[model samples]
Target: MSTTPLEAGIIPLVDAAPLIIAREIGFAEEEGLDLRLHRAPSWSSLRDMLALGQIDAAHMLSAMPVAMALGLGGFAERIDVLSVLSVNGNVIGCSLDLAARMRAAGYGFDFVDATAAGRALIAAAGDTPRIGVPFPFSMHAELLYHWLGALGVQAPQALRVVTVPPPLMAQAMAAGEIDAFCVGAPWGSTAVEDGVGELLLPTTAIRAFAPEKVLAVRHTWAEAEPDLTRRLMRAVWRAGRWLDQEDNCLTASEILARPDYLNVSSEVVERSLTGRLVISPRGDLRSVPNYLVFFRGAAAYPWRSQAALMAHSLAARSGLDRAAAVKAARSIFRTDLYRQNLRDLGAEMPGATDKVEGAMRDPTAVASEAGHLILEPDAFFDGFIFDPTGDE
Candidate 1:
């Protein structure tokens, strides 16, 4: 049988592992997909490639499809998030000088206490700090806003936001173009390794199990080639499950460290996979077990509640119609597609598409088609929970 050829655009990041692993370990081939991976220089380029039909799917920021669906970035297209690719892989860090200032100001570099850390950063940077994020429409940007706003730091007034691709984040910081950044591994590890920045906290510190990236497919293509889309999701889903295994961390790290992948050392990539992050040039290590999740606790499921929360965040900034955007965002997540594709695969399909985001305080068993789905803790550090009804 002839294999269906599909191409995906991705930036070099550790969370892109599932897509790479799908191709590397024959998961794609097993599902009759001839998957070709293309490397984009930046998120904007990757977004354009996906929007322009240059690729069949993309390893995209979790918020990208919703942002596009809501017509935020000037270029609007119907996109579907087939499933979440990775969760909670991002870290916030500052230049070594800023790190020193923050440390000198009596703030210990403990990975917990995100509020205290933000307050310390505010105190350390008296002037507005120029912070870089991968894209304006990214979880990095949203979380930065969420974290800073929680501490009463008015954005663009207390801190300036700029765009720096993941690969160039460390260089930008080193060159003083950006004072700090919120980016995913191994780029955070790269910044620390290069002696330029110190990792302060994982984004999970702000919102544990925060949706990060998605296995995104253009909606038109998915509708036209349903079988191909389902096959691709199943293939990548299997790869994500394989990646979450503790035993596969080392090998997964080595594979992602190849030049065509993250192009960093296996040791750097391994830090994220193992959740043992080297936070500073001084080799300060912090263990963040929920730092990066692939398949655990229904991480891959495209929860509509998450989409609603992101839509709310974006709505606040853009002054978009909150209700309409939330509805559109929820629709774009394509939870139905995820369920349709993976239900028969013995996956523990969630009983409900929407939930109270950031409400779970511990491992709680939820209703599932498979009868057993224990969800991980997903509380915001500030103890705020999102009402899916837009009640706040």
Candidate 2:
């Protein structure tokens, strides 16, 4: 087997573990692939690097490919989501002063009531607070808008949305640059550790099973090297499965905490891996199952409905044609490619390529090639469901 060298780009976040683990644990080597990982500090830089062919693939935000497909970022080339990397690992954090103000305003930081949190935030800050997100087109931004909008706080008008890199979020908050932030894990934990912020709510409170990050590749590269793509997908899938085991959580965190990787403390990274999050500076802990999902419950499947949901949100926010945006976004998920490449490996993939998003209210058994697959509830907090094929 010839060793094919491939460069993959990633941001320093807990969700980028699968790509790092695959290369570190010999999964890529076993597939006859030599993976070179590149660390990118910001989302736009990583997106541009992937777009300009600076990297073969990347660990990208779930909505990025859809954004590229809709021409939102002015990138000409189309990108494809080969698989999901992580789901529902984001948390909203507010500065210590803002948190104290919210508490004084009769808000309970229970981390379950998103509407109350939003209303309290509005009351305490009075439309003047600046909230930072990792990117404009990320699940962090979408969930923040959805949660606040559901509570009658109009976005970009009632409050400001700012873009800050995830790694720099803690420092930004400490420096009084942003009052609050909705970002992926470890960074939020870092803020809590640094005595700068307190956790307000998890993105799961807005929408459980929110797709967070994906294994993305350029369409041109995927089409030109079909075999290599299959090999890469299989290797990454194996790494994800290895990551799902409870015993491997600490080891995974340690690997991610390396200076060459996330460059954070292993203890902070382990919080997300173990689903035991410290929500406050005073060590208030919460047990959130499936916090940073890698493999269980078809977590890696590239669902078209997920893409369509992102498309609808972006279209509604940006004033684009909903139908056209949904159509273009649906093509980027590449569910057909996922099924074609992973089925032979006996992957427990959903029989249907698309389903009603956020409709399941329980762990229901569904049709699958390899017997039954139990899908967990992905209901929205407002009891809304996204029907990609219907007038949602």
Top candidate, metric lDDT: 1
Per-model CA lDDT versus the true structure:
0.89, 0.88
The CA lDDT at 174 in model 2 is 85
Candidate 2 local lDDT, 54-140, one digit each (tens): 998999999888998999985878999999999889989999989899898788888887778878888887666789998999999
Query: In every candidate, how many clashes are there?
Result: 0, 0
Question: TM-score for every candidate vs. truth?
Answer: 0.97, 0.97
After superposition, candidate 2 runs with Cα above 4 Å error: none
lDDT accuracy of residue 68 in candidate 2: 89
Q: Which pairs of residues collide in candidate 1? A: none
Model 2, residue 54: distance off in Å is: 1.5
Estimate, for each residue in 1-392, the C-alpha lDDT of model 1 and write its tens digit.
57889998888889999999999988999999999999998787888899899998999999888899889784678889999999998999999898889988899888898999998998888768788998988899988988888888887467688998777888899899988899888888888888999998899889888899999988899999999999999999999999989998988998999998888789888988988998888888889978999998999999999999999889878888888889899988988998889988888899999888889878889999888999999988888889897564
